[model samples]
Target: MPAVTRERALEAAVELLGAEGVRALSHARVDERAGLPAGSTSNWFRTRRALLSGIVDWIAERERADLEPGAMPTISGIDELIEGMCVMADLQTGPFAARTRARYALFLELADDPELGEPLRRQRREFERWTERIVIALGIADPVPATRALMALGDGLLLHRLTVDPELDMRPAIARAVRALAS
Candidate 1:
């Protein structure tokens, strides 16, 4: 087998955290879960803190990909933006649920560690910048605040769906809020 890459190790760590929570994380465990040889994760991440920090950076990288030009769904108007956001919510709470859960778990897990938490802050700011552009295009008077509110609403809806109501359809509520914001 090929030598395990850092991404492979970080992906395994995220999967483990999502499936089993933060308590189950360890270099050896990540190696075992990744099907890599012993010490593979340790070779990439010398310590648990290093692993956690790597995980945060890796997750942020993945999330940031969605904001790349042309990576986002076509949104020529507020309605399309709302639909795109609902699709995003669906993805976060559906097919990509594991990663989403792992993200939130890590958010809470490393909330106090400013060193490790910086990646999360950077990711949020990047997302806000992307969203602010969309809000500006949609003609919001205060795009910055509007973008923040939109992001907060989406996060809240995602948390609700992930933690409390897996069956909840968030599109309608998202539509209403998006319209309100656009108005």
Candidate 2:
């Protein structure tokens, strides 16, 4: 079992990351946000890298949980798949907005400093592989390339929506892509 303190610290890190950018992240901020003793976060994460790693772990687990049945995406059919795509594209504007922003915050930082993105990329690859499975299960003839296409499209949609238009609704386009892939 994971240590409760570590989890608490990571959760606080998520909140801090969401509320502020990565520049604001530090042992002291996390400890204060988590309501822990001054040195508690430092005990768990001796360095900034370790702290980031923990946040990545927490995000992976949290996103996976959010993907469970009855949660976001709610994948069951093509329509649900479309909803899932839209949900992800719309991640920056809801109750989970802060965490969504936090995830992107990491992505922004990693873009400039690629090394720090290893864990983030690993988590993303896992999701892409899962998407590959879903595409294959749908009887798509070209599952590998199809998975790449879908992921790219989803990523593009998310990035565009977040940066260009917060109200941008690409569900129709996403649905069209799904139909094209299925056909």
Best by TM-score: 1
**Model 1 stretches with alpha carbons more than 4 Å out:** 1-3
Pairs of colliding residues, candidate 1 = none
TM-score of 1: 0.92
Candidate 1, residues 79-123: lDDT per residue as tens digits?
A: 899889989999998888888989999889888888898887888
* TM-score, every prediction: 0.92, 0.76
lDDT of 2 at 71: 67
Q: Please report, in order, the local distance difference test score of every candidate based on alpha carbons.
A: 0.87, 0.79
